[model samples]
Target: MMKFKFFLLQALLSSSLACAGVMGDKPETETPNRLFFAGLGGSYNSVKLDQYFNPLIGTTNIYNGGTLVAFGTANGPAVPFHTTQTTFAPEAQLGYLQSFSNQDWLWGIKLAYNYLSITMTDSDLVSPQLGTLTAVTGAGTGFTGRATISSIQTRIEHEFDLMGIIQHSFKNIHAYLGLGPTTFGTRTNIYNVTGFADIDGTHVDVSGTPVNFASTKWVWGGVVELGMTYFFNPTWFLDINYRYALSPHNKTNYTSAFAGTLANGYTKSGTLFGTTNQYITVQGLTFTINKVFDFV
Candidate 1:
């Protein structure tokens, strides 16, 4: 009876050792196989501007032997213009990721593109005799103008997995932060004039010749992004991101025929021509869906 008990104990010990060896020899589990991801998303942007309006001259209005005019108190009828605009922006991205044992932890690099358009218009009408436009030695006058600008940008991003939560039977969710540099290009067009001047029931045509102006500028800056992503499976996910620029926005200078010749000529004549610097800064939020195609 004693021998039989000892033999049973030895067989159980042998079985345990064999099971441990098999487990130790097995390779680590492979990560998800999806690696390449492409997505399209829309973004909303907040753009702010600093604008400069140079001295403008009208053919029919003369003051002090110069077509250019400035009104003190009683500068008769003048129009005021204000504009508001909204844009629909689109984005696309591609990236590669590495995952650790914790599926929530990841590191990756992304390249993205964005396209946006911005438009603005000015509209206001007041009698030239009001306190605003009293200088013209007559009853006051009324005008309208519009301008549009568009741009496309490409950015390279580097991401760090910040934190996440996962359930045994549910999709994985992760939050991350990214930062990188961006390159952008823009085109601007202006379509505007001081409008027709109506003096005491007589319509004076004061439309300056239409001007065509354009410029291209390159901008470089740092960008910061915060995002949340959910994995439908190990290979597919959706992400929502918000990005902010860390550097100053830069724009190309545009020269108008009137501004260059007339304004410069005034300066040469020892008169003051008002010119202000105008620029816009970009800030945005985006949402996208990404699929990872990992081969390793």
Candidate 2:
């Protein structure tokens, strides 16, 4: 009986040791692998006029009934016609990200869309007449024009944490910096009068010669962004970011009839045409909510 009791004690000690060894060899549970996110935000935009000019002349002689009027040097007033514009824009982004480790370092790529609208107003414009009047008339001869710009941007971004988190309750909050190139396309529309008014304030309808312009071209530029994100959950977070264009430079040329009626009873008309090679910088603050899809 003493030998049997000794054997039983030996068996229990071996079993316990085997169990502890198995437990030790088993791997520790890993952090969940979450990786993709989508977000929406709004931004404020400021657009300014870079350059504009218009010039007109009569290509044909004027014949008022049996009188052959000499098409002398008839010059109209030079009117400055443009206004600066500003407004708010709405934007959306979809991104795919992969985390290096639980230390809070992440690298990602994003595709985004932005919508903006700008307005140009010309007030109290003067009509070009047959006589030498070089002053803008106070009469309501002004018109408003608008331009809409949209863009599709592809970006690569990196996220960095100040204090690298290893073991902490609040370790997901961090700051990040981003930069990338953008290709944009823009559309513009202008509306104005064609033809001169008689001395009795009667408009000589010259509908045959109206001005119009349109364009959709690829514009290239770069952008830089800085922001902070708060990770409320393992796979969910919110961020507030500010972005600015590194090079807001572009050139656009357009031609349209502004004023005056043609001398051949077709009403006089002028073409305002020029290219704007100027810098357009914008500041935007946006709030974004994101969800991660882990695949690790």
Q: Model 1 off-target regions past 4 Å?
A: 1-34, 52-85, 100-104, 121-171, 191-212, 256-278
**TM-score, every prediction:** 0.48, 0.51
Go through the candidates in order and give the clash count of each.
Answer: 26, 14
Report RMSD (Å) for each prediction in the order shown. Answer: 12.7, 13.8
Give the lowest summed-lDDT range of ten residues in model 1.
Answer: 267-276
Candidate 2 C-alpha lDDT tens digits along 1-296: 99999999999999999999999896543323445666677666554443232333322223345343423223233244433455676777776655566545666666655565544444334445453222122222322222211211111111111111112212556566767776544444433434333423544343234444444555566767776767767677776777665236555565554444454553333343433343334456767677666665
RMSD of 2: 13.8
